[model samples]
Target: MPSIMIADRDPNERTGIGWLVSSCAIPYEKVLSAGTMAEVFQLMESQTPDVICLELDMVGKGQWDRLKLLVDQYRPTVLVTTAEATFERAMQGIELNARDLWVKPQTPEYIRRVLTRCCQDQSYRMQMSQETTGVTGRAGEVSYLDLFFPRPLHGRTYPIMLAQLEDPKHHPELLRFFEDYPFRDKPVLLPLGDVIVGVFPDDTHEPQTLFHQTGKRLLMDWEAMSDAPLFLVMYDSKEREQSLNEKYLDAIQALHIRFFKGYRQLTIVERQVNWTMIDPFLTPSEQRLWVDMLHGGDPEVLKQWMYRHFSYKEEPYPEPGLLRIRLTSILAQVRRYMKSHGLDNGDLEQEYHRVFETILYSPILYRIVAEMLLFIQRLMDLVQNQREEVRVDVIEQAIRYMERRFTDSGLRLEDVARHVDRSPAYFSTLLTQKQGTSFRQLLTSLRVKEAQRLLLETSLSVGEIAERSGFVNANYFSKIFKEKTGTTPRLLRNQKKR
Candidate 1:
C-alpha cells in the first residue's frame, strides 16, 4: 500500500498538497500531514509511509539535524517541497538521499507522476536491500541487535516490548527466544525467563504488528505448548533518547499494571494511570485512617487494610497502569512516614528496591501486595511501637518543666503547654493518661519534693522554703506537705536533724 505525509506549517498549502496527492494516480493507504517536527516524529511511531513530502521552509534553523535524522533512519522517499529553495539546500537534500526537490502548489499530474515513481523506486530498493543483506531464511534473519543494542545508533527511536510469561517452567524455551525472536521481523531480544525485552526499529515498525507476528511464530514452533499467557507492555522511545536499562524500568513500571488485570496477548498503551486508581482498595479516608492508625496501633484495622490490598478478585480488573502508580505512591508514603517518625530513609529505599523487584515478578497479586504491605506495615509498626516511648518523653519533659518553674507563682498549665508547644488541654490530658496523675497533683508533688530537699540539704527556714517551693507561706506549704507526705515541714526538718 502506498502512503504519503505532507509536512507544512501553512494549512492552505497542506490542503493543496493533500488535494493533489488524493487526485494523484497512486491510491495512498495513509495520507498524513504534520505542522511541526514533534508531530512528525509522533506520527512516525505507528506509520512510516513510503513517501514523506517534506516542507524545507518550515524546518527551523536548529531542526536540520532532525531532518537528517529522519533520512538516516526510515529512508522514506523524501520529496523536498518548498516555495523557496536554494542550490545549497537542494544539494544538501540530495546528499541526504532525498528523491527530488519540487516547488509547492504542485499540479495533480506532476504529484501523481513523482509520487508513483518514488514509491516504485522505494519498493525496488527494499527488494535489493533484503537480497544484499541475505535475509531470506528464518535462521539468517538480521536483528537490530546485530547492529544496535550495546551501541545504539543516533537519530533513531527504538520500540521496545517487554514480555513476561506467567509460568516460569516455559522459561527454557523462552530463553532461546532471547538470542533470536521466532519471526521474520528480527527483534533485538534480551532474555529473562520471567522477563523478555524485545526491541525493533521505531521508524519502520509498529508494535502491534511486530508483537503479533512474533506471537504467531512462537505458536507455530512450540507445538501445543502451555497457554503460555504473556504479560506485555509496548512503547516507543521516539520522544527522547533513553538507555536500554531505563527502557526496561519503564516496562517494569508498566508490568505493575499487570497485577490488576489477567494475562493479555498484547498490552500496548491503552490506559492512563492516576491517583484514583487505588481508590477501590485504598481511598482517601482509608489513607488518613491508616496514618492515624500508625500512631494508634489498631491491629484489626491493619488486618483489614492488608485484606483489601491482597484480596483476590476474578471480576472487575483494575486498569493496567494503576498498580504501578499505586505502588509508587505507596513507596513515597513509606518514605514520608519514616521521616515523620524520625527514622532514616536510606535503608527503606534499599529495602523497597528489593521488595519492588519481587513484587513485579510475584505469581499472585496477593504475594506482591503482601510484600509491599509488609514493608509499609513494618514502617507503620515502627511508628506504632514508638507510641509509648514518645508518650513517655512528652510526659517526662512536662514534669521537668513543672519542677523548674514551680517557684514562679505566675506559672500555670498554659505556661507549661507553651514551653512544650502543646495546648494546655492536650498537655493536661497527656499527663493524666501517661502518668496516671493530673497537672495540679504533679505540680504539688514537685513542690513537696523540693521542700524536702531544702530541709535535708540546707538549713533554709520553713518560711524561706515555702516561698522557694511556690507556696504562699509556711502554713499553706505545711498543710499541703502533710496532705501529701503525712508530716509537717517543721517535723521533717527536726527528724532530718535527729
Candidate 2:
C-alpha cells in the first residue's frame, strides 16, 4: 500500500478531498493532510508519502517554490489540482514534472482514477528500480525491445508479417533481411521459435549499445535467420518509461532516422525531433511543407519514403521551384481551419494528421499546407506562452498600439496593419490569431479608453468627444461608450464636472 499526502488551503476543499479519497477506497497505508505550505513541509519531514496532491493556488504565492522543494527532497509522484485552467499554470505544473493535473470540482471517479494511476505508476517505478538493481538477475544478460502496432496485424504469424515489412525499397535493412530469406518463413520454423520474443527492460542503457545489442540478440536468437535484426519503437515521447516498443521503432525507421548524432539525446523530445518528413537540406519553403505535414501527422512510412527520394540529403535530385510558396499557402489554410474550430493543444497532433492527410497527395497545395501549420503552431505558442516575458511583451505591444492611436479618425485595421508592416487581412488574422479576439474589439476598447480620458481630463460634451475620438455616429458611439464605461458617457462627463 502506498502512503499519500494532500495539501490544500480551503477547509471545505480539504474535507472534500479527504472524503473522496476515503470513498474511493484507494490502498494508502497513511493519508496526511496539510492546509498550508509550512504544514506540508513539516508533514514531509515526519513521513515521506508515495504520492503528493498539491493545490496549485493553495494558501500563498510561494507555494510552487515550496512544492518544488518538497518534490526535490522527497521525489514523490506529484499531482497538481487547480481551479485555474490557465496555460501558465498548466505549463508550471509541466515544468515541475508533476505526474498529472486535476481540475478542482473533480468527480469521485476522476479523483479515484488519478490516484490509482499515480500509485500504480509509483509501484511500476519501484519494480523497475528493483529490477534495475539486478534482483531478477537478468539485467545485462537479456536484451529487451518494445514493439507497438498502429493497427492490429492482419495475421497472427510473425514470419509473414516480417516478410511484409521487408520489401527492401520500402523497409529498412532490418526488415529487408526477412524479405530476402525464404526458408525462414516456413510453418515448421514458427513452432521452434523462442527466436523472437519481446522483452521489457527495467533499466535504461545508452542509445548506441541499446539498439546495437538488442538488434544482435534478435538475430542470434533465431538460428536460420542469423542476419535478421530487431529494433525498438517508442509510441509517444511523453511516456516516462526508458525503452520504447518495436512498433514505435518501425515508425522511426520509416522516418529514416533523418537526424543523427554520435548518440541520440533529445532536450525537449517534441521540438528537437528532425522528423523524417522534414528535409534538412531542402529550401526553407520545401522544408516548411514537410514540417507542416510532419506536425500534421503524415504517415511515418510514407514520410520516410518521401525523405529517401526527395530529401536534399539524398543528393543529385533537382530541387523543385515554388515548393516553399505552395507549402506556406496550405499551412495558412490549415491555420484558419483550426482557429474557426476551437481546437486546443491536445488536438494539435491529431489535427495535424487530419489536415496533412487532406492535402498530402495534392500537387500544388504545398505552400498552403506549410503556412497553415506555421500559423497553427504560432497560435499554439502564443496561447501557451511558455515564457512569461514573451507573454508580457505581446500583451504590452497590443496595449501600446491601442494607447497611441485611440483618437485617430481612420483607426481601421489597414492603418494598424501598415503600422505593423503586414497586410490588413494578415494583420486581422494575426490579431485574432495571437490575442484570441478580433481587431474590432481592440479598436472599440481603445475608443472607450479615450472616452474615459476625455470625461476625466477635459470638459468636452460626450457627443463632441465621441465624434472626435473616431466614433462616426453619436448615438452608436454613446451606446458602445456607455456599454464599456458601465455608465452613459453623459453621466460620466457630468460627474467629472461636478
Candidate 3:
C-alpha cells in the first residue's frame, strides 16, 4: 500500500490537500500531514512516504539542504508547492527531481489532475525499474555515463560541442544530424532537452582543426534537411579535473553569446566576453538627426546608420537588451514617418508592428537588423512612389504648397486649394479624407512644427518667433503652442537651454 505526505505551514491547507488526494481515488493507504519543516523531516525519518506534497516556500535555506538530502535518499515522488513560481524556485524543484511545481491558490481540478499524473508516473517508473533490472542497456546510455560520471576515460580527453537549434521545436531533429555525421571517430551524441551535447574523440591528427571542419560541414548539411538555423559552441579541451557535465555547462553558458554572433556557424568557446555599457535611448539631438534623415528621403543613409551601429563586432559588444531598446527608439521614428506619409494603414501598419515585435523578441541581432532594413526599404519604396505621384497628386501638391507657405502669416486653405487647382471646400474634404486630419488642424501642425524648430535652433523673442511661424497674435500663438505642445514657448526654449 502506498502512502503520501502533505507538508504545509497551514493546517487548513494540509487538510484540504489531504481531502483532495483522497477524492483523487488513488490507492494511497495512508495520508500524512506536517504543519512545519521539522514535522516534515520527522515524518520522513519515521517511514519515508511514497509521495510528498511539499510547500517549498516554507522551507528555510538551511532546512532545505537537509530536506533535499532526505528527498535524494528516499527518492519520493515530490510535487512542490510554492507561493511564487520564480525561476530560482523552479530550478530548486528540478534539483529535488520534483514531478511538478504548482503555484499556490491552485484550483481543485488542477491539483487533482497533477496528483493523478504524478502518482501514475511514480508507478510507471517503479514498474520500469523492476522490469529492467536484468536488462543490459538502453538508448541514451552514452549520455547517462558521460554526464553522470565524475571523470572521463583516463588518458583520453574528448572535445565537447553543444548545438542549440534556432527553434526549440526542432531540437529532436538535431540529434539525427550528429548521429549520422561522418566523423573519423564518431562523437557520442547526448540530447539535453533543447540542446544536443556531443563529445568527439581526439584520435585523428590535428583533431581540433578536424572538429571545427566537421562542425561547419554539419551546419551546411543540417540546413539542407531543415530550414531552421543551428548554433554550435565548442571547447577545444576540458581541464584535467573538469568533468563532462562541467564542460557541458561551460558550453551552454558560451552559447548565450550566439545572440550577438548569430546562427548557422560554429563558435569556439574560449574566454568570457563582457558587455560594454551603453545608453539605449537616443538624445534629443540624435532624434532630430534621424527625423532629418527620414525627411531627406534617402534609404542608403538609413542603411549606413544600421550597419554602423550593428555590424561592428568589437569586444566588449553592447548588451543585447540595450541594442534592442535602441532599435525600438529608431522604430518609434519610423512609425511617425509612416503615419505622416499615410502609410500606417492595413498591411503596412501590421508589418510595422511585426517589425517592432521582432526587434523586441528575436534571438539574433543580425536577424533583427535585417528585418528592420527590409521594413525601412519597403517604406522608402512607398516614399519614392509618393514623390512620383506628387507631380500629379492634388493632395500631395496641396501639402507641398502648405509646407512652402506655412511661414506666411496670410497662408490659408484657399491659397493651397488654388495652388492645387481645386475648390477650397472640395480640397478641404479631400485633405481630411486622405490625411485623417482637418485642414485647419493640418495647417496648425505645420506652423507649430516650424515654431518648435525656431524655438530650439534660434534665440528669437516669442513675438518674433510667432510672426515667423505664421501667427498674427503672440498671445494666441502662446495658447496654440501650449495646446499643441503641452508647454509654453519660453518654457520649451528654457528646457532646451538647460
Best lDDT goes to which candidate?
A: 3
In candidate 1, stretches whose alpha carbon ends up further than 4 angstroms from where it belongs are 1-322, 329-344, 496-498
Candidate 1 yields a Cα-based lDDT of 0.67
Candidate 2 stretches greater than 4 Å from native = 134-498
lDDT of 2: 0.54
| Tens digit of per-residue lDDT, candidate 2, span 288-402 | 6655653454444333534454335332223232334344344554455455445545757566665555444332233333434454555544445444455455555755786
- Candidate 3 residues lying further than 4 Å off, grouped into runs, are 1-158, 166-173, 182-186, 200-229, 240-246, 256-262, 313-316, 340-343, 380-498
Error of 2 at 100 (Å): 2.2
Query: Scored by Cα lDDT, where does model 3 land?
Result: 0.79
How many pairs of residues collide in each model?
A: 1, 32, 0
Task: Report how far off residue 13 is in candidate 2 (Å).
Answer: 2.2
Cα RMSD for candidates in order:
18.2, 27.9, 23.2
Model 1 C-alpha lDDT per residue in residues 256-310, reported as the tens digit of each score: 5566555644455422232234442446775676677655655566668667765
Candidate closer to the true structure by TM-score (higher is better), 1 or 2: 1
Name the weakest run of 10 consecutive residues (lDDT summed) in model 1: 269-278
